[model samples]
Target: MADDPILRLRGVHTHIGPYHILHGVDLDVPRGGVTMLLGRNGAGKTTTLRTIMGLWRAGQGSVHFDGRDITRLATPAIAQAGIAYVPENMSVFSDLTVAENMRLAARSGAIDEQRLDWVFRMFPALKIFWHQRAGVLSGGQKQMLSVARAIIEPRQLLIVDEPTKGLAPSIIQNMISVFCELKQTAVSILLVEQNFHMARSVGDTVAVMDDGRVVHAGTMADLAGDEALQQRLLGLSLAAHQ
Candidate 1:
């Protein structure tokens, strides 16, 4: 069904040790486009992504992906169900070569030549550093490699946490281009981003979280065009960032 959400969270609550991070977060990530999750610091945006990936278990409520209940699934099981997650740290193997890191990401332990070629085309720097140690790459290149590993093979959903954090504007623009291109492939994306420029550039739908709950949900264009709403939800206008 074209209108069905690729991922859905209903009345979700998450507790990280003594503190409860999410309070009944209800979000729907519609298939085939980037859904940007935006909020101020301490909004539980990252916690929501972690909970969805099974890194943190929901204390209450349920999560559904592809119309199936996945609230209780393990992290690996959630990943095996055609989802890929790129965390904020860009966790590439420091001691391994770029090629080796990518190979490890492949479920079959064999890199698909065609897919590898596509990734190289999207991020030419990866090809340049194919044999270089991942630890030696620059911060931007490491971020690219993290994304490359996630998409080394096909996936139904790609969840990225602040891919542009600490990156230069030029590098962030490049990452945005890759994400825009990825949108054309009909793979659903759930992105938690503070970079308003990157969010507005790649997002089709937008959800704004505040104090562990989603306070706004609508098309990105609507929020982008309404400065007052942006100020009210995110504390600053998207225009100010542009």
Candidate 2:
């Protein structure tokens, strides 16, 4: 809602059936930069993302995006508001070719050649396997397609979850480069990742979650250099993870 952060969550609480997953999460994804959401397993990081996307309704609090209050908007409406989400599963259509998958993501029903070229530049393998079935592509390629689909259109925000989950070191490095390039673009990013190495590489800012709440919010450089603070918040320093 503010002019700075493209996305803002204040005192957000979410419940999935009987489980209360989030307890007053406060986070901000500043415009035109990458904000890493770091936390341990079951820390409600995924739930927080789902809540923002309207996949899971927040039980209380508010979600604001680009100067609009989107807390009650439906998933389709939320996406229409220029927030693109790539879940942790890398949800590409297995039965469809890479081109087909990309076409589906284009809301206009026609792929933009210029945007396609940009995507191809970031992930060259997508262009190589453009006509191949998505199921036939490797895990890294599928992940690339998923990301390419999200960026096919010009968007204000891109939220990705664990993009480097099963990728090799080389592929992870490629992704790091892609994200670095993305940072220069107009879109801001809210990335939820457990890969601390990738987090340290691409994160400009950070928010650490624990037991469904954001325990720390600060610049990535500060957190990366302070092993003591890292241990207190994350139980291990970035060096340990490295």
Candidate 3:
């Protein structure tokens, strides 16, 4: 089964300064589908993501990706290993044009026209504003560009953190469609989101985190259907949220 999960974490503990954030976190991102990491604010979801990316080193335990131990690798090294991260901030270069941003994220120093065309299909705004500066775009458009940049090149896994944090309802629906399309591709996705509606829509598997540890893991359909389980684990029913 080790070959099945593209990414695995075991007892991952991360500390930022004197504050202990992630405490013995364990998770698995199965190959070729969306695995949603869901939790309330301050539930250590972000810390867990940062630790996996090697932005924050794990104090104990291990992180394995594509069958290799990457617990101690630096951020750049981890990225080079074919993992792409789209942080919540969207991190687009405000001064750079949309085309410039894509060029920067390509990593190969050259953007492939075919891959770009595919990305444009998924997010038409990027194509419309190709020559425009990233800072001038709307929040939703910026998020699309952030995602487009990540997939401009081939990747084994894509990790996104709270992508729908501040978008409108229509934009959220668009994001749902984007993730759905991404699932059909060869790349796997690990997503952290608070919107249960979006989470249940795109997620094939779900992991719930609380107090820095994963409290539940199962199919998204199970979590969505069980109002009692959702109320207990997530403090609300998924159906009610939708």
Give lDDT per model, in order: 0.94, 0.94, 0.92
Give the number of the best model, judged by lDDT. Answer: 1
Candidate order by decreasing TM-score: 1, 3, 2
Misplaced by over 4 Å in model 3 are: 1-3
Candidate 2 lDDT: 0.94
**Residue-wise C-alpha lDDT for candidate 1, range 1-242, written one tens digit per residue:** 13689999999999999999999999999999999999999999999999999999999999999999999999999999999999999889999999999999999999999989989988999999999999999999999999999999899999999999999999999999999999999689999998898999999999999999999999999999999998899889888887
Backbone clashes in each candidate structure, one number apiece? 0, 0, 0
Ranking by lDDT: 1, 2, 3
Q: Is candidate 2 or candidate 3 better by lDDT?
A: 2
RMSD, one per candidate, in order: 1.2, 1.4, 1.1
Query: Could you tell which candidate, 1 or 2, scores higher by lDDT?
Result: 1
TM for every model, in the order presented, reads 0.98, 0.97, 0.98
lDDT of 2 at 27: 91
- Which 10 consecutive residues of model 1 have the lowest summed lDDT? 1-10
Residue pairs whose backbone atoms clash in candidate 3: none
Model 2, position 83: C-alpha lDDT score: 92
